[model samples]
Target: MTRYHPFLVFLHWLLALMIIGGLIMGGNVLAETPNDDPFKLVALRMHMAMGILILALMVIRLVVRLVTTKPPHADIGNARVNKLGTAAHWLFYVVVIAMCASGLAIANMAGLPAIVFGGSGAPLPSDFSAFPPRMAHGALATVLTLLILGHVGAGLWHQFVTKDGLFGRMWFGKRS
Candidate 1:
């Protein structure tokens, strides 16, 4: 089995960590932070910044994927499963980019005070439901979360049941 390029593996894990951490932090801020708390604004801004970073890194990942060669994927003999895997991979890219775009839209539509990096707070437009993008942002977030779970489940299936070692392709370590 051909191993993934080291740089691609690095970006994969880095983005994964950021996305996971950002989601946890964002959820905490949303559920626990008081509206009057100054930290809430900072947390929200940082979440937005992380989304932007994810977007930038995702674009670079796609570009790198195109320019570099990937190891040939072995078919698991189930045509449906193969197709689903391919679809899921593409959907991962689409959902991530959509999430970032929708997040920006939500921020732009919000009418709350937001603090950007290295800048003071500014009042944003606050009615999220009044803006279509804000609604989409919420919906997309749910979709992204579900897709991530499905992706992980599938990887586990390949690793344990199928015993194909497919998960190791994206995992860190020396290439065999």
Candidate 2:
């Protein structure tokens, strides 16, 4: 096939927007808002819900990817660079899944489900830093951000510099 399955393409773009938005919401809005702030609860509710949805979509995307026919991997005339590209694609899945898992860990450990979702009326912890998973969540977010930048850079390079049409493979088009 000359292009990715349409469903996979749709998932790729959908997840891209969700992941980027989630990172911004988590890193900026949620991070700056103190746990005591009433708005923090609202932001937490939305952020947690989005994270859960992203996790579900990612799992489905992975399964669809494994089962679908896809174009051959792109080559940019360097074996190491090609392998790095392959590894980075796989790493996206690993880092994103781990990021979601760490977020879930923090929520469960901090009793966030009861507070944020269940409306149990329990107060949020004075600080999330006390939770070990919070640290991992932040670190994974940084990694995921870097990976995204690199992926975009590589795609641009392939499209503009190499002129290999690699970017089009992941975009909407006829599969053949």
Which candidate tops lDDT? 2
Give one digit per residue, the lDDT tens place, for model 1 in 1-176. Answer: 36777788889989989887866776666536665566666777778778899999999999887787676765899899888888988898998899888888766656432345535556433434577886777777778788889988988888999999898788667766
Worst 10 contiguous positions by lDDT, candidate 1: 111-120
**TM-score of each predicted structure versus truth:** 0.86, 0.99
Give candidate 2's error at residue 49 in angstroms: 0.3
Output the lDDT of residue 55, model 1.
97
Model 1 lDDT at residue 44: 72
* Candidate 2 ranges beyond 4 A from true positions: none
Displacement of residue 29 (Cα, Å) in model 1 is: 2.1
Q: What's the distance in Å from true for residue 91, model 1? A: 0.4
Per-residue lDDT, model 2, residue 75, is 76
Spell out the clash pairs found in candidate 1.
Answer: 110-124, 110-125, 110-126, 111-124, 111-125, 111-126
